[model samples]
Target chain A: METLSSLAVPTVLILAGLVMARGKNAFDAFLRGGAEGMRTTFSLIPSLTALICALSMLRASGAAELLTELTSPVLSVLGIPPEVIPLAITRPVSGSASTAAFSALLEETGPDSLAALCAAILMGSSDTLIYVMGMYFSRTHVKKARRAVVIGAVGAVMCLFLSAALARIFFRDAA
Target chain B: MIGKCFFWICSVSMVCSVITGNTSKLASAVFDGCADSIELSLSLLGMMCLWCGVIEVFRDAGFVGALARRLSFILKRLFPDCADDSDIMGDIASSVAANMLGVSSAATPFALSAMEKLDKRNGCGDTASDDMVTLSLLGCSSVSLFPTTVVTLRYAAGSESPYAVLVPVLICSVICTSFAMLLSRLTAKNKPLGKEKRKSLGKRKERL
Candidate 1:
């Protein structure tokens, strides 16, 4: 599994090499494209800076914990384990933060625990909504992302519920 | 809209921290966050440069067009509003292909490029178009064939069966993606371009 996952980049490189070999002015095109990418990256800095600052503030202020605790009642009713609440709250906003939360959950509950399994599934099945939103909109200079953010959040919440349900069904006997 | 949200969250959090007397912690977090964002953007710059270059080669060799042609049937269905010969279609195809393969770092450039193409087609000035919203939604929903990072983490954490979550991840991802597509289609406000408009846009693209 590890070998297969690591092969994605090599496969892409090989394919790109084959295609470039057949193309005219491949080097020039590559350089131009890289320059364009650099421009996009330059434009991304402001938005990324703002969003990350806000995220850091939220984390440091313990707002994320507060939000998680506030939502735990509803999540518990939905069969989500208490240990996974922080993961759910942070998953959309920050990838690294949620991964940290997930690792903490695993360490606290042991990797084989049902909560750990559910956390893994939730983490795997959802993208970082806010991060993607920031990157995409910043690149395109789109001012209105409410619709995209709302829809993405809805999908993440739906996935969370589904992950918990599936974990219950699959890991019931083990637990 | 998102910018306001970020500002609001930052202010609210800052106020709360002040009220809670965590001023020192808040100050440190602000500096650390700025530093972290810069580091992340720099790393992303390298990855984007590499993949964008490769994508350019693919475009130069007409591989993207060929791939788009092969996948046009599904692409047309997913993005019916986008024209058949639009370069955006090829970009979208490449982005989705990279995403499903679980190489998100490689996927970012294609996704960003696709959004730019969609923005051009929409002619919305600075606002997001319906297709852009849909594409963004699609990008956010995890559609990877293998949840590689999650599995690796589980294994490192000493799980005996790290692959145990694979099936559930696949099922949930499919559900989330389908739901997002459905919602986006239902709520999309931008009307499809007229036939003449599409033709003119295609001509403009060709002239470029």
Candidate 2:
């Protein structure tokens, strides 16, 4: 209820702007971007949608819960709180879903919680490399990206690791 | 297409839950979760439109061209295969600018346009040169300094301190971005620069 209203505010504001700009070539730009977006969505969404469904089943079946339990102690050495495992798992897979997961953590456990902070930090800093990158580059003819791919994946993980480490440093008291 | 996929995923997940006799629980959970998601997406859409309009205004005011001029050096280093006058700079700048606003959707076309501009400039119709790949990859991993969409989601979800992630987000983005740039330079170095332009890419100190 509160969430939907807050969300509606921005959409309405943009709608107003769109109305104002409607006569100023906004409609054409919107349609063009929409069409292009639709095409690109087709290329990637099939596989991604399937994965999300599978993941949802996993989440429902408590696989994520089990995995979180399994990795919690090991990740404790890494300084990431147990609650952040979902973010570390999902952010690399789906940014939006991770955002939801992280926000739910905030709502359930309170926002200032170090785990929520780490999850938020990780989400903001890292890219959904597997999904977004794979989707985008599949459109172009890019074959020789071995080094780029390596650097990208490694850098994403490094950022994830750095987020956990720095979160512990910043929120040592909170933790 | 995505809509169909979503419909399918929902159906499949519902079937799975029913088989496990937890359909009601998961469905209710999904319903609540989706309400939040739709809202967040709306907020993101608005913020993205505002930023897009702002970027358009900046472009109208010659800021876009100025940015291209300012990025000539780093752009030169990152994309030595491209000429100074190429449209790749605009694409990169626009894409980066869009990402800065947390509008990944808005950034996509600009990124594609940028890559296309690079390919055309290098006269590589089929095989993308290494520089293009690095730039595209770097763009994909934009490592945003601020994540407005995520924060908005948090705030809407009743986060007590939505801004707490800001500092860590900036730090991690800076590290990842620097790491990406350094790695890109090392990988793409001296390969396309041949023998002449390689020297120019070295520790260039200049003001545009």
Instruction: Quote the true-contact fraction of every model.
Output: 0.66, 0.28
Interface RMSD of each: 7.4, 7.2
The number of the candidate with the highest lDDT is: 1
Give one digit per residue, the lDDT tens place, for model 1 in B1-208: 4456577777878887877777778878888778866865665677667766766666667654465467657666668677564688777877776677554655789889988877777674677887788888888884766675576556666787777777777788889899998888778764344577568768979999
Q: What are the Cα lDDT values of the candidates?
A: 0.74, 0.62
Q: Residue B11's C-alpha lDDT in candidate 2?
A: 65
Model 2: per-residue lDDT, tens digit, B4-121? 4346546656666666666556745654554544454554454445444543433344443565467566656666565465577667766666665455666778777777666565
Segments of candidate 1 deviating more than 4 angstroms: A1-72, B1-71, B190-208
State the fnat of candidate 1 relative to the true structure: 0.66
